[model samples]
Target: MFKMLNQMLNRTLQRVSLFLLSVILMACAGTQSPNQVTVTGGTIEGSLTPQLAVFKGIPFAAPPVGDLRWRPPQPVTPWQGVKQTTDYGNDCMQLPFPSDAAPLGKTPAEDCLYANVWAPKDADGTTPVLVWIYGGGFVNGGSSPEVYDGSKFAQQGVVFVSFNYRLGRFGFFAHPALTDEAQENGDMLGNYAYMDQIAALKWVHNNISSFGGDPDNVTIMGESAGGGSVLAMMQAEQARGLFDRAIIMSGGGRSLFGDRKVSEATQESLSGEQYGLNYAEKHGITGTDAEALAALRALDAETVVDGLNLAAMFNPAQTNKPTWAGGPMQDGELITQTISDALQQGNLADVDVMVGATSMDIGGNPFKDKDALFASFGEYAEQARKVYDPSGQAPFQVVGYAVGQDRTMQEPARYIAEQMTSHGQQAYYYRFGTVAQSSDNPGAPHASDIPFFFDTVAEKYGDALTQQDQAAASAIHQYIVSFAKTGKPVSDNAAQWQVFAPEQSNMLNMTRNGDMQHGTDPWKARLDVVKAAVESSN
Candidate 1:
């Protein structure tokens, strides 16, 4: 009996020793690796793929909650030890639009000022960086969408970074109480959404070098509202020198405040203070005092979101008196002038630019009839009809759609290229005209070029994605990779993309058959008419 007892004790001790040894080994292994990096917050360990080292959910700013709500991004709270960042952080608080092209992968929450990075596994600080900003009309969008993945970028030998910014009212509100607070504290007022973007760019400038990216060689790119952000950054005083190049994707290069202007003192059609007051009154919280501000911040995130999404933004039933500010405005400090103002005044950063729109983009269905639509073009009505509908038999709806596209996106794209070329900067213009094999649309729809740019067509199309789709994605992705690496965009797989010059008016077209064609723009007459109308209106 004594011998059996002694033998049992020995086996138990051996087992305990093995368990401790395994634990020690794991702890040691986790302590150091190429997958681990120290960012502004703290040391974070990421995951490794065959091609890249990916770090996700590294907080770049403090959670915009409590008193920090609606304030510019604050410094990230430092952490103690290595934090695992293999998963995505919560996306910015917003009601997800069901029909969104790039759906959020993470849950939406207010504590969501996080950035993600992807770098080649063998990186040693020589790779160029591409920072992506998403678009959901500035009301919705997150960086966690699968279609926004940066693995392909890392595979192609460039570092990619993306982050979330506050959206909707939480991002752009401006209450009298807040204005008073800003005055006292010397903090910037309104346009918190843009403030967040500038902060994110600052973070990238400071931390990208640690992840094998050249701090000096960075390209800022975005789509739709994100594209507008790219344009804004090119002129915003605070954003200068943060990036050296930009790519604007269907971001309208025009005045955001049309005929009206945003002012803090006067309650104009687009007054930020008036909008804030309206919002406060709607919630039964009135007054411009500390108590009012506290009550506003005390509201729950969902109550704050209040069903605001892209669908609700465009819903015809929204006849109620306006509460929220439409979106980002000329805040004077961050966004000193409108994108169009800056482009026209030659205030843009001296950098190479690539700007374009899809064949079909936002802006369709405004006029009641063909006559009204053509007449809206003013002095150019005859020219518009000749360029848009020489046949006089084309479907009014189709003609209306074409007019809207030209007015809002197509003409603006060409005009931006023209301005850039005139400013003596290299400008590359493209028209995404590729129609998916499974899609019945007449041309590429708005936001369809996102997956192609990221080379995530498989995620966007799934089983419906074809060989042709893959080829187009490859061609487009190569051009982007080339642009991010060098100042110029080039792709051996596709036809050479020529620089846009006023003399030639060259633009690259990703044809409906998933091929690239570079030459003079075919719709020059239509765009010229739209340009004349815009200039006359201005």
Candidate 2:
């Protein structure tokens, strides 16, 4: 009897041990990981890599569809359970550009007001935040491009964020009926794209703390149209206090229209309201009433986009008449004045800025031939040719392109830096001239510095990436990261960045030999002529 009792007791003890082990495992599984965060909408769980915790496709606002079309972004609808933000949401609605440098990862759709985040796995409330705004001429870019991945930034102890805004017609449409609706509700009119950008920044200001980012240390950065948006944000009354530092890459600081008509009903360019009416009439929908708006909203998203993108906008055959609003205009509440006007008046946000452009960039007055282009400079024509086409043997297209670069990109970058410096704010200017080893281009073309700034040259060049490219990317990326951490940009791998001053005209140039050189701008004399021509015209 004693032996039988002993066997039964042993079995009971073994069962109890197994049960205790199972309970411990279940408890561990129930504990929430750092990857799961509670935001304004609800609890969201993100996927984890070895070095970072990444969250994508978090809705920052309601879908601008149906009745909400052409209106300011609305608050996101709250959810009941943990939302899995593992994959990227759709990019803003538009036809994809065929030769785009940064291709979209997800399909384009109207419901694309989503925000993404990349934070250190062990992030603890002290990391600085960097918000990225993409550029496709205000028409074609998105946050889902692989080259825009912020893993390296996260690994460097910073929280990186990117969000999608409306693009093309879907982003910048205006009409008589829409204006009526806006006025009735006291809503701001036109420039809905800027409104979306402001909304996303507001969302970051409110929610980034939960992701272990310091809300007070936010930096906004963009390239091209995105850079233009940053300039607008600096002067926008509603956008004040939203960001502390800004980086403008190839965003023109001078007036875009130059002596051309900007917002009057003219054969060259129609006002936003007139352009909207023209678009509505073409769609077989006319009138300035609620019914007209309903019909406009009822149109399919694809129809509204109407095959618009960066290329289509510039194609003369497609854009003989103004179809879209052309982009952001003076919407009194948001954009009170032109960016150049704001800078001249010193009516801008008190924040430090880092502005720059590629060696070869896009810009120039519209002219039929090189002769006409040079003549636009009036008495400065000979000086222009002397600096731009000194050989006098270059092709018309080459001279035109270089002239455009000076007026639109190179000079404007220097102008913005000069203005910010005058405002008693620290300004840093750079000129990226390092030609990628895989390319045969004469100089760094427009938007080519994006991958380097984000430290994703490997993704950009793939197997063709060279050691020189890697070194260039590392140096530029370090400057950006250092800028985000502290207002001053310092790179241990490169030379010390000096503050820009009118007298010194100091700038950091990423040379073709893959060296970072700090000195006066190489094209200061050329830029001075361009500046004089622009000033005379204005």
RMSD from true fold, candidate 2: 3.7
Query: What does candidate 1's lDDT look like per residue over 1-538, in tens digits?
Result: 9999999999999999999998789778754677888788889999998889999998989999999998888999899988999999999999999999999999999999989999998777888999999999888999999999999999999999999989998888888899889889888877787888899999999988889899899999999989988887888888889998999999998765333334544444657787788788888999989999999999999988878889988983464557777787666677776677778889989999999999988887778998999899899888899998999999998899898888889989988899988899999999998877989988889999999999999998999999999999999999999999997788876899988887787889999888999999888888999999989887
The reply for model 2, stretches above 4 Å from the true place, is 1-31, 257-268, 318-321, 368-370
Measured against the true structure, the TM-scores of the candidates, in listed sequence, are 0.93, 0.92
Question: Please, what is the whole-model Cα lDDT of each candidate in the order they appear?
Answer: 0.88, 0.88
Q: After superposing candidate 1 on the true structure, give the runs of residues whose Cα lies further than 4 Å from its correct spot.
A: 1-31, 257-268, 316-320
Q: Pairing residues by index, what is the TM-score of model 2?
A: 0.92
Candidate 2 has its poorest 10 consecutive residues by lDDT at: 256-265
lDDT of 2 by residue, 256-370 (tens): 4222222345454577887787788889998889899899999998888787788877773454556677788776677777788889889899999999999978865578887
